[model samples]
Target: MAISPQELSLHKLPPQNIDAEQAIIGGILIENDAIDKIVGILDQNGEDFYRDAHRKIYKAMLSLSNQNEPIDLVTLSSTLRSGGVLESVGGSSYLAALVESTPTAANIIYYANLVREKSLLRRLINSSTEVVTRCYAGGEKIENLLDDAEKIIFEVAQDKTKRSVYHIKDLIKHTFEAIEELSTREGHLTGVTTGFNRLDDLTSGLQPSDLIVIAGRPSMGKTALALNIAQNSAEAGFPVAIFSLEMSKEQLAQRLLASRAKVDLHRIRSGKLKNEDWPKLTTALGILYESPIFIDDTAAQSILEIKAKARRLTKQHNIKLIIVDYLQLVKGRHDADNREQEISDISRSLKAMAKEFNVPVIALAQLSRMPERRE
Candidate 1:
């Protein structure tokens, strides 16, 4: 197929560094030890390479490495030929040139970083362009488009670098060091403190990447409990994020202030306070205002919307805990035909978000009313 001039110009090659890719490959071929360093730097697969030949060559190298085979020019050429891709990858001559191009393996990490950086840039450009095209098409609601655009951009920007396989020796060393650190701190929490001494002691605090669900019937103070934890975490200098699907931001603030000041919620809502209550109210407001807590009271927030906002908060504020006012109120990215399925999808996404951000997520849920009848 032939390409038109306009299309050719518009689709000009994506950001890439072919020389760096070749240098990385050459370095690995020269010294097997360099493979570990290159993998650490790139932390990606052969698909990250820009050129088809380079992709095939890297794939072959990875295969040999995984199989505990040698990765010299001779071995690489034989593997490529056996796979029927030697000619497609420019034959053994290209492999020889790659080795000749790299003088040493010491700088292999730098070369690999260049390749990875170019790949990330290419992803950013592609993602942004797609978002722009969607905006122009006007097929979806503006709000939905905005949510999708933000989701795509967030995924591209916050995508964690791929992890390379680690040797058991390295892992054991890390574990030994961690155990030593824990030994020195007797009775100290290993994770974020939840402000309840008994609960903290039982679970060693709200662990990172954990999804904690607080379930109860109506009038059980689920919101109050979540707010209390958020306040406590924030006061301890840990950043907190709250998604209030059931209440507005103002209402949540009032509740927090009431809890902190030990005042009746009705008095605060009705704006009727005694002379001494003013000082308590002022103190509560000051404390909460100074704490590193953020609230997003977006009613009926979709899982995608929450994830995007949570990622931004994680990047900007380094939040340690995320609280969802209630789980039943959150919407899923795709509306399921059944309500139960929708809730399930939302719950799964929340769990994924917690793991991705490496933060503890506390979600409030309503329990079945069947228990009431059992009594």
Candidate 2:
């Protein structure tokens, strides 16, 4: 379930009342100089061991501390070793040295817990155990929750920064190489091709992560255009998956046959197939079946079902493109008061799925009550 910010605000625990016992427990203070020693050990040994061994230990310590568990060194080491910290960080001795040098009792306890839990080392170093414990005990402050959440946010930011740095460096070095590749035109375009010769030229074929929305009112050949594009792409050796919410698979196939055989779609639908037409239809069917154009004719499919089917097609046949007949007909998981919101969600999900699978998604949509507009 998606969590709203308001609901999250309501879920925080109230602050605990720190009595004499609590104070005494929290007051068993370790010196700042001792913390410097711990820092020295970590600095000398490097960060790799702590990053590996103490990562989980830190996390579990946070969890246990949040639940008000009194932490001890023996228990911390056992938890650390059990959580695979020894193998990750180098050894148990490294964990002990780091913990011994930590500054505050709270930090020492927290670091010990963290090394056992394998929590984030930087967060452990920066955050005070007293502050974390106070928040966990009180549970009323969003600020406290935000502080805890910062660890994850910081890691993500760091990862993104690293990726961006690498990408920028690579881009600088390979700009000429990329230009050369484009100049040479050495690779085949591996996506669905829109049937229009001029459009195909402009796009160099529809690339993956593309959301091509074809919109039209009644009798504007929207379906025909989509079918033509699907057929053309499939014929060009790319696997295609088509979801037919408005028309049956057989009906769509007959339209393909009529298009191929130069017969009338109306006549084919009306069962007026001629004696000569039988041979042409048979030949068309044989060719269409052999091609990598799969069709699903289920009515009023939910977005989840569409996603599942698309994934299956991708896995089974390596489908490179997906075509949904119309977006408004598809249902979403949310119960919105307006149909527009539902449509928006469906469109968003389609775009997300396209990105998720790295495939081009062409979804047909219905225009509002307005005259035709061209892009």
Candidate 3:
């Protein structure tokens, strides 16, 4: 009977111990096959050719040998094109030169890296056999085998040391510098400024990865305040992503345009848009669009989906700040008995995501219902 995921065995659990022998055997097979295929291609393609295409082919071969990525005609062509080699050459003549001149040891090294993806390696080897058979004749087998074995050992050792070293110190330092640079600018006009004018005077901008929570009762203009902050940040060349669960993108855009054009929000929402209002709305939208503000109006987005979308935005547009319309609208991953616990989890996750992405997260939250008093 098949075991369920929850009932899976812990005994002999670590795959490292169970698959050690199989891994070693697999590694040997991969290296041997790769060497044989590369040699065969070179043997079939006769020597004594010099061309730009040949140079591209050789460079691509060398890159694959070092990187241990699978080699195919398409990938090879793409790599050559990226390296400005394809533009220099007209055809596959340079590729022919590469197959003819690459050393047997280099071919073996390339195969040694293929141990992880045995099936894919096998397919690549089998597919290229025709080209291999044409270029290479059978060489001294034992000598090539020994060379491949040594190459695998050295490469594996180097990879282990490489994983142990961390080179992120410089990256962290540069990120600190960037945060400092941003902290010197004014953030949003109508938002809370930490209640200290001197500190706000020194550091005009809010630091990145900050979780600014705005709590207020109904009709407190919380959404308006948040939008103003987003607009200010976007206007300052800082990309902002707004997740509005309560409103549609068009509705939110309308509010921003009204704010920028100094028009009343109620007038725009009530569909009493005047003829003179057209120019202001259009001009405001044009300015906001060029300022790098992105809005997502998905109703009731889960925390996981929010995180995923935020990561994509950060990567694609280099988003510097994130704003969520209201915290209560967002649901957490778990189904909790109390609403408070769910809110807590959502808050924690949002804060964690801000730190992970190194961007500011401004979350708007609703206040609890006020107790009624006797008049």
- Cα RMSD (angstroms) for every candidate in the order listed: 13.1, 21.8, 23.1
Ranking by TM-score: 1, 2, 3
List model 1 lDDT by residue over 1-375, tens digit each. 987443654868788999998988888889975665555344335767889899888878866764457899889999999989999989889899988988988888778778888887877777777767777677778898789778877766654353222211232232222111111223478888777889889999899999999999977989899989887777766788888888877677778778878989998788888788877766666666566778777666666557666776788888899998789888653437898988887788788888878999999998888878999
- Cα TM-score per model: 0.51, 0.48, 0.47
lDDT values for all models = 0.76, 0.58, 0.57
For residues 1-375, write the lDDT of model 2, one tens digit per residue: 986434553575322221221221222222322222122112112221233233354443433332234445555556656766645654556445544544335444333333322223334433544345556578567875777668656753452232100111122232222111101211445445666677887887888998889888767888898888877777666778888888876677667778866778887889987788876665555555555777877676776557766776788888888899988888664446788887887898899889877999989987765543532
Off by over 4 Å in 3: 1-203, 274-276, 372-375
Q: Which pairs clash (backbone N, Cα, C closer than 3 Å) in model 1?
A: none
**Candidate 2 Cα errors over 4 Å, as ranges:** 1-190, 274-279, 370-375
Report the lDDT tens digits of candidate 3 across residue range 64-118.
Answer: 5323455655566677778777657643444334334443333343432332233
In angstroms, the error of model 2 at 94 is: 38
C-alpha-based local distance difference test score of model 3: 0.57
Which residues of candidate 1, in runs, are more than 4 Å off?
1-187, 333-337, 373-375
Candidate achieving the largest TM-score:
1
Query: Which candidate, 2 or 3, has the higher lDDT?
Result: 2
